[model samples]
Target chain A: MIIDGLINGIALGCIYALVALGFVLIYKATHVINFAQGEIMMFCSYICYAGSTTFHFNFILSFFFAVIAGFLLGALLERLFIRPLIGYPILPVVIATIGIAMVLQSVAALIWTFEPQKLDPFSGSPYQLWKVSISPVHLWTIIITFILIFLFSLFFRHSLVGIKLRAIAEDLIGSMASGIPVRRMYNFTWGLAGAIGAVAGILVAPVIFIHPHMGSIGLRALPAAVLGSFGSIPGAVVGGIVLGVSETIAGLYLPKEIKDVFPWLLLFLVLLIRPEGIFYTYEQKKV
Target chain B: MKKIKVLAIVGLCVACFLSFTSNTIADTGVNKKVILVGGSLDLTGPAAFMGQGVKRGINLYFNKVNAEGGIHGRKLKYIAEDDGYVVAKTVSNYKKLTLKSRVFCLLGSTGSVGPKALKPYLEEDKIPLVGPYGYTSAMFRPFHTYLFNIYATCEDQAKIFVDYLKTELKLENPVIGLLAEDNEIGQDTIRGAEAQVKKVGWQAPVVELYKRSAIDFSSQVLRLKAKNVDALFFPVISSHSAQILKECQKANFQPLLFATATATDLRFLKMAGDSAYFGKGLRSFATQINHRDNSSGAEEFRAAIAKYDPSNKDPNSFNLFGYGIAKILCEGLQQAGADLTREKLISALEKMDGYETGIFAPMTYGPNNRQGTDSVRILRADHNKKDFVIETGWLHPE
Candidate 1:
């Protein structure tokens, strides 16, 4: 039972980490939280479903199509909604993102009609290893998440665009003055976040099935992002894994009523001790 | 001549007084041209599928009725307000419908919490709510005269499940378990199953509760498997039921599964895939006849949906429920006659005895009995056909 819970928790955590990566990416680059991250994921999953079922594309082709569509959607949103309010207060931008979330959800419902649709998993059935049984989908989720993390790490370390994004995160005004094409970078960052969300959505869709409200799972990942420190990329992954493992282990021991709230409770306790999250370092800024 | 003139004036005043009193006695929502029926439903939330299905079904029936010149020369005008499954929003929609729109009665409001929240106001205002789509025991308990429930309560369904296991499956000493949502609906089912177990002189079943938002059921399945539970009763919604089935398949644990009428749909089968048809398969208790049933009512429903709502390509169990409940409400309206009022509607509904709509089990109601039926039909998924097949005739809890 313990082994099963651990495997399940790790798999669940990978999904959370994947979603949290999207949140961290947008926040790190633009310094504006994209509240619609989950909605983008949900909409993209529907697109993938449509691509496979409606358009008669194979699963791999549908997956890539949805991801590309997600990229275009994110870039379009940044250009149309985010860019217009460049000098505005963060509250309005956040509210605008929330509004965008609502619009996306409603549009998805209009298209898909709110009926839960099934997506064929990449692999069929679970493989048993000793006493523990793990789903192929979960195995794929872990592998893909690790690969994404590695790719993202290399990009940030070496790529010029990644360096410019980091510069913008550190000093937005300075980067803007240093010939960083700030608006285009912001669009690209959003597009990247959308692509990551698309991958997360398609991966998780097989497990949870596809629905308009499936994006609410993104809200669950928010705690993971907070736990890892909202701005740190590696922190999101660690935070998600910690949250998932602890939640499952707690379910094994704690009262069933507290299971849903366990993750939030763990986040609360961590925040109480270290307000800057597990990976966040306090930086002395000159006012 | 003066006396004659005075007598004529007195006669005119008396006739005018009678006319004023007659107009005052007329019902609020009933008019010469139409009868306004209203509903507060979750048209744009997590349960939007249910809300939309119920709405479409009701509209399908109403459109058919209206096309046939309506009941007693008054057309049925349905005005549905989206509550989004929120209690406060349901109450607000109720107020808008009754106070503002002045609907004669509420027909097919979805969800248990919303209808439960409206109980007090329903009684206080002396308004009739006919055929609300919920399975909670509270819908009929304490016998709210204004609220009419159309299906067997979750508790009754649970009892029926236990009975089926003992009588049909012949599992005399089988270890039983329950996986339910941690809410009133879950508690109600638990109460029924436990009571039935005690009645049958069996060991108390292992019980596990989960949150509604929970997608993963690995821990619950593992715990149940650890207990060696041979049969499991899950009274959760369709999506959760499918997820649990998948989890069980992953863990290589195949227990005889029992679910509520909510899971007796094609969608559940699709979601669960091969896991659903594994082992003894999922035996679900259904309140309404399956849409694919060859019964006359089922045929009529399919034809009506095709004629009235061609846009709705896939009609499921919820839609069938909505259509069944609408039939009952319309029956009550027909029985109430042209001089319609809330009280008359209530009186008409209470008098219904073994009224068979062909879609639902024969329903009987009395002044004290608001539950339309306590009987449920068992359904099992046919893997080959990819649809539900009716396993048993309507079985009563007792």
Candidate 2:
């Protein structure tokens, strides 16, 4: 049972990692939180479902269409909503994202209806490793999350645009003065975050199924973001895995009602003990 | 200017007097033209789909009734408020609907927690709550005068599931297990299962309750497998049921699964996907008859929704429940003879004995008994047909 829990925990942690990457990407680039990350993920998943079911696209084609849709949606949302609030109070921009989340959810429900729709997993068969059984979806989620993380590390460290995004995140005015298109950077940040979240949603949908409100699961990833110090890309992945394993092991020992509380409890402890998070170095911000 | 101001003030006072005195004119949402009823539903919550389906079902019946000149010249108007499945929100909606809107009664308040929270206010106000969609045992045991339930308690369904396995399936000393939600509904099922375990001399079932949001059921399934449980009693919604069943199949653990009505929805099949094979032949205690049952109620519901609620061409279990509740409520109102009061409606509802709601079996309620039905039919999930098949006629708990 513990082994099974460990496997499942890792699988769930990978999903939370992908979602945390959504938060990390937007915050790391723009220094503004996108509260609508979950809704964007949900919308893109529905697009994938529609692509497969309505448009008769194959799974790969469906995924491609979803990622493109997610990118466009993020770009459009940033252009329409976030750009206006640039250089304003961070709190209001955050508040505006919450509004965007609500609007996006309502729009998704209107388009797709608020029912749990099914998406076929890419490939899955119960496989055994060392006499312990693991689900195909869980295994695939881990594989995809790691691949994305590897690609992300290379993109951030080696790619020119990646350094530009880092520069924008560190000093927005400095980047703008240094000839980096600040508005374009913001749009790219939001778009990339949306695309990353779409991957997570599409992968997780096969396991939990798809619904407009399924995006609420994205909220669980918030603790992962916090644990990863909210800004560190690698921190999101590591923090997510730790939180997932903590919950699973907690379930093994604690009563079921108390088990779900483990994630929030961990979040509190992290904040109380090391608010900088496991993978982050705290730096003072100047006004 | 002063004279005009005095006239404006007099006009404002007159308007206030007319609005405040309007209750007497309508007699608390009842009038010669319309009767305003209310529903505190989870129309925009986690269970929003269920709430919307039920609301559509009820609206189908109401729109049909209204088109046919209504119940004795008074049109039934159902105003639903979205409570988001929160207890406090349900209470707030109920209070606003009753105190401000002066709605006559509440139909199909969404979840057990919401209804359980409203018990005190219900007792205090004495507003007859007809067809509340919940399965709390407290509603039945220490029965509230105003809260009239539409279905058997979760405990009743649990007992029926166990009894069916014992007698009909003939499982001699079966090892039963419970995978339930951490809520009153889950507790009720556990209560019934525990009682049966003691009665039949079966070993105590390895029980585990999960948070409503917790989708991972691998550990629970593995735990059940380790215990060698022959049967698992489930009291959860369809989405969670699909996830759990798939997890069980992935682990190669198959047990005789018996779920409540909520888990037996056709929606589960769609959600279970290729993993739907695991749900094959799974059983559940059904509240309303299957849409494919070819019964009069099924036919009527189909025809009604087709004409009145065309959007809901394929109504699920929630829709049927709403249709049944509306049917019963309408009958009681008709029996009340157009002169409806809280007391009168309560008396009329209490007098129901073997009253057919077209969807459910004859539901009888007495002064001491407020439950709509104590019987449920057994349904088997048929993945091949992608629908639920009725396995047995209506059977009560032994």
Candidate 2, TM-score vs. the true structure?
Answer: 0.90
Give, for candidate 2 chain B, the lowest lDDT window spanning 10 residues.
B272-281
Model 2, residue B308: C-alpha shift (Å): 3.6
DockQ of each: 0.62, 0.44
Each model: TM-score of chain B?
0.92, 0.91
Model 1 bad stretches (over 4 Å):
A282-287, B1-27, B310-312
CA lDDT, every model vs. true structure: 0.88, 0.84
* Clash-forming residue pairs, model 1: none
Candidate No. with top TM-score: 1
TM-score (C-alpha) between model 1 and the true structure: 0.93
